[model samples]
Target chain A: MDAIRTEALTKHFTVGFWRPRPYLALEALTLQIGHGEVFGFLGPNGAGKTTTLKLLMQLIYPTSGHAEILGRPVGDVEVKRRIGYLPENPYFYDYLTAEELLEYFSALFGHSAAERRRRASALLDEVGIGAERRLQLRKFSKGMLQRVGIAQALINDPEVVFFDEPMSGLDPLGRRHIRELILRLRDRGCTVFFSSHVLSDAEALCSRVAILANGRLVSQGALSEILAVTIRGWELVVSGLTETALAHAQSSAGIRGATRLGPERYALELPMTVPPEHLLAKLVAAGATLVSLNPLHDTLEDFFVRQVAAAPEERGLESTRG
Target chain B: MRAIGHIAVNVFRESVRDKVLYSIVAFAVMLIAVSYLLAQLTAGQDLKIIKDLGLASIATFGLLMAIFIGIGLVWKEVERRSIYGLLTKPIRRWEFILGKYVGLVLTLLVNVAVMTAAFYAVLAYQGWGVDELARRAWPAPPMDPALLSAIALILVELMLVTGIALFFSTFSGPFLSAVLTLGLWVIGHFNTDLRNFENVVESRAAAWLARGLYYALPNFDTFDIKAQVVQGQHVAASYIALSVLYGMVYPALVLTGAVAIFSRRDFK
Candidate 1:
């Protein structure tokens, strides 16, 4: 069975007093995530990523449709026992120390005193917060709080974990630590579902990714398939070329554009259909010393930009591209 | 049951650390102590004045603590977005509501107990140092055991107010909840007056409205035996039992309503 599935789930919110208007936060979001896979939900701000996570967690009720986690319907208490969630920008009780807060959360899951103590100490250390276990949450920084938030989420040792903007408000080192922790969760055979706008992080961690734009799924599939852009061409660099040779190269067939690197040096881009041997021969024949040649590959950031820039009408249709 | 206990204990711990709780408790103790000085100003009724003022101080301060703290008990969690971690847990919504209520009640109980102890200590000191005039005017001891019954009834009244505060807090912000709870408290004390106003009014609509409010509002006067206990009037054991039962029933109904509203809420 899938770890998470949504069937046309929708949510609408009403705003304003003079003339109440309905705003669609999430619309007909149908998705399926398999067990034991690290799935990434990618979207820009206000793209309904947090709203979708909130719906699955039952933090807010949906206006229409349904979702199931671990083969049980959303809002099921039993299902919640097997799932851990860390919300974006989580704020805990400031008066509570890290140890006390974790113990309190573990107690809600019916952990005994000895178990709570053991689990709280272990999880705090796992999140790199062992030194601050006895420090009150109010004294901790944002990164420290985020680490403690992760500890609290894992206190129950849930089978499936959902994180919304897990790496938000963290330094580079903190971000790397969280990324490693997420990878560890996946390695332990836990199905991890997380939402993030950081395309690079998502590219590194997610086996499968789904892109959301304006409350709709624009694309979803394996990272390799979705980011697969066929190589359009190659570039060749040469130096010690005369002005006449440079002009000739610029006007050559299959040469898309030529850029001057410095005095008597030029970089040439050629179509894929063009033979590199022909271009190199032409440069050598013109007495231009060969410099370097390389091929360019499309990155996940390029695909994300293209997906986000697509029109709303084209989004749902573009999901079939991968 | 375990989840409820967990939440309740956490709430109690949070409440104990709040500066508001400490400030109110200290002020209440100071007022109880100041009542001893005020008693000397009254010639023959010094003991009676001290007993009345001391008990009144405990009830008044206890009511303020209950309303202020109870209204924010649930609202603070939502305001700070801490409810996200809690609601996503294995516990149900009703359990969270009940747990917060129980926690605040426990805190109020402790504050009232301390204030009651301080009041009794003052009365004990006064009893030992009574002048010739006070000794002749009042043969009865100043440290009356009956006062404990009055304090107990006041605690019951504070519990009902806490329920009212919690009930409003489930749906409204803290400020509005405090206002509505305080408004209800004022209206509840005048429930008898509302019934009398219904009979005296001529307009059918006005009379019906007053009568409806009288039946709808909680009758807090039943729990108030401060005057009787201070004046050394006999209070039957049956009266105490019935009043305590009445106090317990109102909060139970209010809590049920609160849970019903809270369960339907969307944390968004």
Candidate 2:
């Protein structure tokens, strides 16, 4: 069974004060997510990424259509017991310490006191919140609170987890830690679905992805299928090159983008049509040393930008969809 | 039920750690302490004056606690976006609404209990008469357990206030909720006036409007047995039981309404 499925799920919000009009927040967002896959829900701000997660989590009712998780309806209590959700910009009662917050959440799931204690301690430690676990959440940094948010979501050890912008508001190291955590969750055979505009993180972590633009699913498929993962080009960093040779490489038609690194070094990007060996031989004959060569491919960000840019500017907004 | 308990306990913990609650309790305690000193100036009415002031302090502070804290019970969760995490849990929407109500009620209970304990401590001092300073004739025993019956009614009244506050909080913002709750509290205490409002007014429609409101609004005067209990007059056991039952019944209905409204709400 699919870990999550939505059949023409849509949402419309009534807006305006005097003359109310319907605002389309999410279109007919029919999608399927299989078990044990890290499905990336990618969209720009206000693109209905959070709205979709809210729909799946049953925080808001869909205007029309239905959603199911773990082969059950969206609001099934038993299904909820097997799933975890981290909301966008997670907020918690700042009065309680991290341990107390987790314990309280565990209690909601009916965990025993001893089990709550063990889980809270272990999760807090695992999230790198050591001594700070004793301090109130109000004292925690945004990144620290994000960590706490993840720990609480995992406290139930859910089979399917949904996270909304999990990598937002984190430093580089913090982002890396969360990335590793997502990979670890995937390794455990847990179906992980997360919404993010951070395409690089999605690129690194997602096996499959769905891109949303203006409340519409613009594109979705396997990473390798949707993106050209094959080497599109190669970058050769050359050093000790003569000025005349550097100018020749810069003016070469085959070299797409060339940049001068330093006094005697230059980096040249060549398309797949241009063999790196030919460039190397030419550069070596011109008394240049090849520092290193690396292959480049199409990134998720490249696809995402194109998709969002090409998508119509919110089509059929005047009419309603069911 | 278990989810409700967890949410309630967390709310109680949140209330316990709040500095505002401490400030309110401290001010109420100080007012009760001042009541004792004020009673010394009255001749032959010290006991009456003290009991009146003490009960008044408890009721006013308890109402303040109920209105202020209760108004935020749901509003805070939604405003801070904490409800998003909670509604996704393995609990029903009615459970969330019921849990919030129970938690705020529990917090108000603790506050009322603390204030009641302080009031009793002052009464204990009056009874013990620190260092043989006693020898004053009293209208009633200073340490009256009957005071609890009055205090219990006050708690019931606050419970009603909490339920009404929560009811508004579910559908409205805190400012509007507070206004509506305080307005209802004021009208509730003067509920008798609404019943007899026809006598003061000339218009028949206004009188019927008043009569309609009389039945529609809570009769909070039912819980006010402070004067009878203070003056050592007999308070009927049946009356107290009926008032408590009414108090419990009203909030249950209000909470049901609250759950209905909250269940259909979108947490945007």
Best by DockQ: 1
Can you write out model 2's per-residue Cα lDDT over B1-268, one digit (the tens) per residue? Answer: 8998888888888888999999999999999999999988988787788899999999999999899988998888999999988887899988887887888888878877888898888888877743333433555688889999999999999999999999999988999999999999888989999999999999999999999999889989999999999988889999999999999999999999999998888887
Model 1 achieves a DockQ score of 0.76
What are the per-residue Cα lDDT tens digits for candidate 1 across B4-61? 8888888889988889789999999999999889988988787898898899999999
DockQ of each: 0.76, 0.69
Which portions of model 2 show Cα errors greater than 4 Å?
A229-296, A315-322, B129-138, B198-208
- Compared with the true structure, the alpha-carbon lDDT of candidate 1 equals 0.88
Query: How well is each residue in A142-197 modelled by candidate 1, as lDDT tens digits?
Result: 98988888889899999999998899889999899999999999999999999999
lDDT scores of the candidates, listed in order: 0.88, 0.88
Output the number of the TM-score-best candidate. Answer: 1
